[model samples]
Target: MSITPTPRILVLGASGLIGRFVTDDLRQRGCDVVGVARRFSGGQRVSPDDLELPVMAMEASALAELIRARDIGVIVNCLGVLQDGPGSDTGAVHRDFVVRLLSAIRQSRRDVRLIHISIPGNETHDRTAFSTTKREAERLIAASGNPHAILRPGFVIAPSAYGGSAMIRALAALPFELPEKERARPLQPVAVEDIATTIAWLAARPLDDETTKAVTWDIMQPEPVTLGDVIDRFRVAFGTAPQPRITLPKLLLDAGALAGDLISRLGWMSPMRSTAVAELRRGVSGDPQGWISATGIVPKRMSEVVGARGASIQDKWFARLYLVKALMIASLVLFWLVSGFIALVISFPATTAILTSRGWPEAFAVPFAAITSMMDMSIGVLIAFRCTAATGLVAGILLSVGYMAGCAILTPDLWREPLGALVKTGPAIVLMLVALLTLDNR
Candidate 1:
């Protein structure tokens, strides 16, 4: 397996939570690791050695060329989406991508070992599109006749959190109790380190090792754990004292999922999507004996994995503000949209009258108010989309500042207005700054 002296290890979706950790762990172990992601920048902890490519968009031939050119001996595919939405298609990411990947592996004519990360569930239990498509990918990989190992990890707890893990952390930090049904649901957890270790172990296996090749195994702790058990562990880790907790009704959870779905269409990958709730309801559990027998690695329990040490200040801040961040962004979007709509549509004449009062001609003031109102709405639109949210926040902040300054110079009397309308821009500006600062998803 190590014929090339320094064989290359390519990790797809390298910017992701699990992908980032796996890529770093492999490189630290002296493996020639090349990471790939849709978009990577220095701020995102992307190594200069990593390649920035939209891997999901690549065809079989393109993938084959890259695999051959890089002399990639192993590929760890960590690319996946929680649900189908804007810029995320479960079938495309899980099923179609795997088909192309298998074809590319054959065309490359290299002894590439595919270490695919998948969910832990059987076909009958695969109700959501995310689980269904993932199972389909597993089937394709098993039938492809490639040197491969499918690792179905259960409730992965990683240091770098996102999606469901982040939501769990938020819930743990907050002083609230989950419903009895959710609390009692089985949730077999596994540390991200164990998954990486399993992959590294498989990568070093001999080509003729029948046990490790073309095998699908569930990689998780053997001991049974529940959802409430995980949250309590996290609360202990955060050093939060026990208090009277209000249990939320199932109806509220359903509403949150619907809202999450709406936000996902705007390109924001909220973990509260209906599919996430569906999968959570199904619970996470599997037989890990096969993985244990093959790798001889004991999986770490939840306590050992997440609650080994007290939470740091940064960790506490992240856990507390995770869900609040979404709320703050949503509020800002609505604030801008409503403010613009009020000025343009609801009170168009009044909007221009204020300008005219400052010795501005009626004709010029009318169009000026109209254009500025449209600009405000445009900023809201920008902030609503994930890719341009930062730009929109910045624009909103600058425009707010401009408005404050312009009003101060031209219409100082407005500052003395009873409603304090001009002064309200200050708080809006501050909110936009906060949103811009906390915008990074990683």
Candidate 2:
């Protein structure tokens, strides 16, 4: 008896919300799956089975070698960025990477089936750089003359939350509603499971299966839903009573988007970026009949996906703290930045006088205060940036401890000062620890 070989599937960006689910689902179905992601760091735990590679920077030849070496039969590209920032480029990630992947497939002389995940919109509706680059990628993939399937999923809802889903959950947990205009926009959602199943179905088909090849289908539930409906479903899952919700103003939402953009440059992928706001305004909608008929996937609706059993304690905690986390980080940044700036720039003489009056040598006290203030400022700067936030938090905790210890020995009277300046460091340190603990987006 001959055994049919299970094709090896390569999932790019396997650490992402959708990619991780797809990778796990495919492996469960008995297919050999190789998950590749650009280094997984911080709290976003890396799977021992997944490979860490800067795939976006890899050349076509290098990608070809990886494909051939892994004996990969299908490539699922789930890699994407919400906006352009320090380490993320919309054009490079969406279009340039796909171009090289297609080239690599051809170079390997393998019949690799490319499954490209894209946004739900055509050129006319492509407003932001994110959408423009995504549309270009689709065009490139279709014209590549390779066997491929483009799956454009709408407002994807997965068990694990990140980006827009995280924002929605946060909103639902709050005692507020988006303005009626914003709430009424279409937000047709599809379960991440359906997307994984679609990929698996295509993978299981024969190479000559013409139906799955070169097709671009929007994979979503047949019936459309409003943003308000999705939020209400989450509210139901959370067991929250329907009360008069304080509607958020448009001006506030726009300002939040501006703040989100600033945060993005610091390395954090905030879901409230201008691009996300614009997309939210435009709403998500696409014809799912073609994908339904092709893959026979009955996508789960928002209610089914959120579940009727109600949210777990962990879910409630996460939803409530989602926005708080941002505030905590911001406060910490300002606490350090402003304090340091004042000490180093505005109150340099007063800052130096503290140590000097404590019976310290003038020469030693001057440099000591200056250096420490600069260190404080550095910690604040580090915490402000997403990439270095962890290091900054750690440094902050340690330096804070050092300051308290040093103060107790050198200037014990300062602790009992009316302002309780030294005493407050304890809570600040605790906040830093909390920020570090909750930093992971995945």
Off by over 4 Å in 1: 1-6
User: What value of lDDT does candidate 2 attain over all alpha carbons?
Assistant: 0.90
Off by over 4 Å in 2: 1-5, 41-49
- Model 1: lDDT equals 0.89
> What local lDDT score does residue 312 receive in model 2, on the 0 to 100 scale?
97
Candidate 2, residue 66: the lDDT equals 97
lDDT of each: 0.89, 0.90
Give the Å shift of residue 170 in candidate 1. 0.6
Model 1 C-alpha lDDT per residue in residues 161-249, reported as the tens digit of each score? 88899888898898878899998888999999999999888878775688877899999899999998898899889887475678989
RMSD of each: 1.9, 1.9
